[model samples]
Target: MTGLLAFTVLVALVGLERVAELVVSVRNAAWSKARGGIESGQGHFPFMVVLHTGLLVGALVEAWVRRPDVAPVLAWSMLALVLASQALRWWCIASLGRRWNTRVIVVPGLPPVVSGPYRLVRHPNYVAVVVEGVALPLVHAAWTTALVFTVLNAGLLAVRIRAEDAALETLPRSTEVEHA
Candidate 1:
């Protein structure tokens, strides 16, 4: 019973985080659009939203139905991962600033961001997302949710990353022209 309540609270917190992200995404989307941003991979965006929403809902439902015993070791490790993923996600958002949007909107003249986590991984935000997809459910012993979301998110990301790369293909050339 106590575990169930705790898991419920965790889901609520994650939902809140999703709300906050949406606020940022909306603001950033507007900023990008005002600057002639061209959106790419529009079709996959809806699936991404559904997948994230399903993660939150599925975690709660799975925990309630399965009521699996939580191993302290697993829980602790997953908690660490969840925290790390959140930090990385926010870092990506801050690094991109007004240029960040939930959609892949490429503003032709803007330079690609190579700072923050992006310095190491081209898609650091997606890395955080993948980590969170697994960690969040495992924290509550929802292995099924974690596995399903990870697999589905993987497919979506394959499409998303390709679109993003195509959108940013000319960034280097544009940057060079500006500096020349």
Candidate 2:
């Protein structure tokens, strides 16, 4: 298969992985709601959904329509970053377990989780998100998508992270630094 075809397949696989994440998010959301979890950032949820979906669609469209030349070194390096981002994302889900969802929900009285990737950074998932945003498109030389997504996502994340921090604040603080 040609490089473009392979990149398409890769993007399709990532899309499928996104579906899997939604499945988990839905289940976890229900679980959280059952426990009286308060959700913040609802206002931005729709935009987040559109932007993330657009990431996949935009990357594929640019790759096919623009037919950008994919250098082997760049493609391989970006592919590695994409895979690493996925791994980090899943690690976050595993660490948070039922506490993890696409929406920002915090269970009152519960202490912030400081384990796994959270130990290293306050929002490791977002780190994964930023890396994937740039790396995935550049894997196929979809620079426009990469640039657009990064800019839009940065604005979205600024709102999202603030909302998340505010929601997490409802939980009781622990002696350890809060990184959930």
Candidate 3:
């Protein structure tokens, strides 16, 4: 019963996060549209959302029913990783500023963002996303969450990377042209 309540709370938290993201996405879409931003890969957006929702549900179900026994040390470690992932995700957002969004939008003539986290990896946001997907559930010893989300997210990332790469392919060649 306690586990079920905890899992329910977690689900609520995840739902809140999704709501926040949806709000952000709406604002981002409006901002980009106002600036005549080009949007590609609209097709994959639904799948991404569904998969993330599934990840949270899967974690909750596994933890509540399976009641996985997680050691304190491992739980703490996973918690730390979750925190670190959030930090990295925010870092990516802050670094990208206006360019950072859930959608793949490219503005013509504007150079790709190449500062901060982008300097290290072309897709730091995705890195944070991947880490969080696995770490969050595993914090409760739900390895099921880690495995399911990692595999699901991997497939999503494959589609995302290809779409983003293709979207950015049309940029005018220059000295600062960065490749992922």
Candidate 4:
């Protein structure tokens, strides 16, 4: 099979993984709502969805239309990063469990999660997101998609993180110390 074909399969797999995430997010959102969760950043949610969907579509379109010659070394390395991002994303989901939602919904009085990947970074999932945003498109030499996604995602994340931080402030402070 051609490299483009392989990359297409990879993108399709990632898209399917996204569908699974939505399933989990919906269920978890219900769980959080049951516990008096308050959602913030609703205004940017539609943009977020469109941007993410565009990532996949743009990558594929660029790969097909541009038909750039894929460098094996870059392809392999980026593929590794893409896989690592997916692993990190799932680790975040596991760490947050039912507390995790695509939307910024925080339950009142519940302490912020400081376990798993959260111990390392306040928003490890976004770390995964940033990495994947660049790496996945590069897997098939779709540099334009990667660049555009990164720029747009950066602006979106700025708004998103601020809203999330504000919402999280509603939660009680954890007494547990974070170890360096």
Candidate 5:
């Protein structure tokens, strides 16, 4: 029963973290709108929601319901990745400021953000995501979750990255900014 309670609390915390992300997205949208940014990818929004939601459910089911004990080394390693993911996520948020949205919103005249995490990699957030997708499940020895989401996210990322690049290219900021 204690294990169950602990597991439930963890799930709730994860959900809350997602809610916090949504709040950031909302704030970002307001800023983008004020800047006359044109947001696209309406069609992709729902799919992203579904996929992220599934990840939560999948992790709970694999980790809690199934109650698999992960290898100590693997769990520690994944925990490290999860911690790194949090750091990177915040880095992206801070670097992008109000320009970052859950959806693609391109503000004209605002050069594509190229600082902090972006300076190191064009898509550091995605890197965090890919790492977390595998790490979260692996922390509990949920190989099934790791394998499935990794593959699915990979495909989704291809489309997502292309769309984001195309959107960024049109922003006025791109005129003088070079893609790193």
Candidate 6:
């Protein structure tokens, strides 16, 4: 019905968004590697991939099967959150620019980014991920997917952030650079 169509469109959009992220990640990863980037947290990366893929698949399956009544308030609110999440995600990406990759590969001499959302948060991208994982599902009343993805993503982020921090610890911090 109409709900299914809406859910399908949402999932399609999310899938497209992920494809774009991968495109950017691949390019940036190569850029970083060319500049002597060393990758950490490689072990958990596959799981992270699977988990994210599951977020989309699970959301679609649950929303279709459960057919939960969409409370306009919850749906609209969560929709807004989903939109905000994408904005925050792109902000993190734009902030990092050539330095942003999905993987935690750090270039030794390069400065830690202190621009955009980085000024406020150590891992603003992860914040976007967490919010999107929860809010995207809730947009169509897929509470099960939201809860599961949130918990799993939390564990993943803990490992990811730790590995990233460990890697960063070996490098010297540079003063923030002003961008136009």
Compared with the true structure, what per-residue lDDT tens digits does model 5 show for residues 1-180?
A: 454445456556767878998999998898888879788767777888888788878887877767876567986787788778878888888778777778889877678877777877988989988998888777767788889999999988888898899987885544234321
Q: For residues 1-180, what per-residue lDDT tens digits would candidate 6 score against the true structure?
A: 596678789889989999999999999999889989999889999999999999999999998898889988998899899899999999999998888888998887787888899999988988999999999999889999999999999999999999999988877786695332
Pull out the clashing pairs in model 4: none
Which candidate should be chosen as best, given TM-score against the real structure?
A: 4
Question: Model 4: residues >4 Å from true position, as ranges?
Answer: 175-180
Q: Which consecutive 10 residues in model 5 have the weakest lDDT in total? A: 171-180
Q: What TM-score would each prediction reach against the true structure? A: 0.93, 0.96, 0.87, 0.97, 0.89, 0.96
**TM value for model 3:** 0.87
Q: Any residue pairs clashing in model 2, and if so which?
A: none
**Relative to the true structure, how large is the alpha-carbon lDDT of every model?**
0.87, 0.93, 0.78, 0.94, 0.78, 0.90
Query: For this target, which candidate reaches the highest lDDT against the unseen true structure?
Result: 4
Cα lDDT, model 5, residue 15: 78
Which has the better TM-score: candidate 5, or candidate 6? 6
**Please, what are the lDDT tens digits per residue for candidate 3 over residues 1-180?**
564465467667757866876677677767766777799998999999889888788888788888877777876787778778778877877676666678998777667777777788989889888888888787777787789789988999999999999888865544353322
Candidate structures ordered by TM-score, highest first: 4, 2, 6, 1, 5, 3
Name every residue pair that clashes in candidate 1.
none
Point out the worst 10-residue segment of candidate 3 by lDDT.
171-180
- The lDDT-based order of candidates, best leading, equals 4, 2, 6, 1, 5, 3
As a TM-score, model 4 comes out at 0.97
lDDT of 2 by residue, 56-130 (tens): 999999999999888899999999999999999999998888889999988777788888988889999999999
Q: Tally clashing residue pairs in candidate 2.
A: 0
Name the lDDT of candidate 1: 0.87
| lDDT score for candidate 4 against the true structure | 0.94
Clashes of each: 0, 0, 0, 0, 0, 0
